[model samples]
Target: MTTKENNYTSLEVGTFESLLSRNYKGIEGKFFIGNELGLSGCEVSLNRLPAGKAVPFVHAHKKNEELYIITGGNGTFFVDGVEFNVQEGSLVRVAPAGARAYKAGDKDLYFICIQAQAGSLTQATHEDGIILNTKASWMNGKK
Candidate 1:
C-alpha cells in the first residue's frame, strides 16, 4: 500500500543532487528522507565523493549524531583523529562531539548518512507521551 504522506517510491528513483550548500568542497549529496518525508527525529541523505577529494574540513555536531553507511567504492573516515577504512556495507557512527572527515578512494565513493539528535526520539515519543504523526505531516505539509 502507498501513503502519500510517508510512502516514497524508492531510493532507486530518488534524484541525486548536489549538496544543498556549497560551503563544503569535494562532495555531492541528495537528501532522500528528510523534513520533506515528515521526519523530525532523524534525516537521511546520500553523499557522493569523487576520487582524490575529501570533505572540506573536520567538524563536530553540538546536538545531533550521525551514522554513515558506505554503499559503493571505498573511503577513509577520520573520527577524532582516528582513521578507518570503509567500503560497501561498512557503517560508521559519530557522536555529537566526535570530529569527522573523509576522503574518497581511487574511485568515487557513495554513502548514506543518517542523523538524529541524541535522546530526541525517545524523549519525544515515549517519555513525553507526544505521539508524532511523522508520515501524515508529509502529505499535509505541516506537523
Candidate 2:
C-alpha cells in the first residue's frame, strides 16, 4: 500500500501583489484571495472597497452561510434593512437567507469573507467515498 506524505499547500503571503480590481455597475474595488488556492468545502476572499463605494447589491445564499471579518477602515453593513457599524476587528455572520451588503466610509474598507455550507465541514474525507479531482484550469481563463 502507498501512503501520502502531506496534505498541505503554501500560498504567497502578501496581499498587495494579489489584489485584483473588480467592478460591477457602480461598485468598484479589489479582491485578494479566491478559489485559485484549491481550498475545499469553503470559499474565502479578501475584499477592499474604496471610500464612499458600496457593494453593488444585497445578496443571500440558498445553502451557504457567510462570515465577514472586518480588518481595516469603517463601514456600514446592512442586513435586512438594519444598519450595523463595522470596523477593524469586527466579525459578522450572516445566515443563508439573510440579505446583506455594505458601504465603505472615508477610509478604504478591507474585509475577509468566508462562506461554507452549514455542517459540511464535518463530513468524512475520501475514506467515506469522497473523491478529489485533479486541479482544473477553468478559474485560470484556460479552455
Candidate 3:
C-alpha cells in the first residue's frame, strides 16, 4: 500500500512593521511586530539596539509577561534591581509587573521579544531616574 501526500506552494508571507515615533521613549529601530498564532492575548517583536543605547530604562508591567532572546552581540541585563551579563544565545524572562532594563555593551544588540498579557506595554520614568513600567493598555489604540 502507498500513502498519498499533500503538497503546498508558497504564495505570500505575513509581515508586520511599525515605525518608531519621535514621541516614543525608545530610539529608532525596526520593530518586527506580530500577533501570536491563533491567540489574541500575545504579541511579538524583534528589536535592534544600536551601539551605545539601551532598550528601555528600567520598568515593570501590570499584566504582561516579557521575554528577551539575544541573537547577537553582548549586553547587560538588569532584572528586579539586579544586573546580569548577557550575550549571544541568552534568554531573559520578566514576569508580570516585574522591573527590568538592559543596555548594549559596546556593540549593537539584536534580540527577539515576546509579550503576552491583557494590555499594551509601556515605559515611564521614576523619581530616581529609573525607568518604570506603566501599562500595556497605552498601545491599544496607537497601533
Candidate 4:
C-alpha cells in the first residue's frame, strides 16, 4: 500500500529481508523509489549485487553527484583511477564528473544510491527547517 498526504508521502516497498527477493527489470534485487514517492529533490535506488559481480561499465554523471551507502556485505569501488575497498557502514560520495564503478566482493553487496544535483543544496537542516507550535497525535498532553 501507498499514501500521499497533503505534505508528505508514505509507502512501504518491502522489508529489508525481502529486498533482494523480488525481480526488477528482469534482474533480481533492484528498486528505485524517488519517482514512486513523488520526490523532487533526489533519485534513490536500492540495489543488491551478487558475489563477484560488477556494473560492467564505468560512467560519470553530467550534473548530479552520487552518494552510496553500503548497507550490507563488501564491495570494491573504482573512481577515476583509484580503487578502494568498501564494506558495510561505508559511505561514499562521488562528484558529478567522477567516473565510477563497483564490484561485489565474495558475498552479496547491498547499497542505496542517492543522486542529486551538485551544489543544489543552498540550505541545510538548521537553515531550512521550521519548528511548528504543535504536539504529536500521541503526545497531545504528555510532557
Per-candidate alpha-carbon RMSD to the true structure: 8.3, 10.9, 17.2, 2.1
* 55: Cα error in model 1, Å: 0.5
The Cα error of candidate 4 at residue 92, in Å, is 0.4
Error of 2 at 119 (Å): 3.2
lDDT of 1 by residue, 5-123 (tens): 34553233333334433222334554455744566558887777777788878999999899999888888999998998989899998999999999988867778899988666644
lDDT of each: 0.73, 0.76, 0.66, 0.89
7 in model 4: Cα distance from truth in Å? 0.9
Model 2 lDDT tens row, 1-143: 22223785556545632343554343454443444566777888777787788877899999989999988888899999999899999999999999999998987788888998976765565656855575667856676
Error of 2 at 45 (Å): 0.5
Top candidate when judged by TM-score against the true structure: 4
Q: By TM-score, how accurate is candidate 2?
A: 0.71
Give every collision pair in model 3. Answer: 58-131, 60-133, 61-97, 120-136, 120-137, 121-136
Write candidate 4's Cα lDDT for 22-113 as tens digits: 66666577788888899999999888888788887799999999999999999999999899999999999999999999999998889999
Q: Per model, how many backbone clashes are there?
A: 0, 0, 6, 0
Model 4 weakest lDDT span, ten residues long: 15-24
Candidate 2: where are CA atoms >4 Å away? Answer: 1-6, 16-27, 30-34, 121-143
Comparing 1 with 3 on TM-score, the higher-scoring candidate is 1
Clashing pairs in 2: none
Residue 58 of model 3, lDDT score: 77
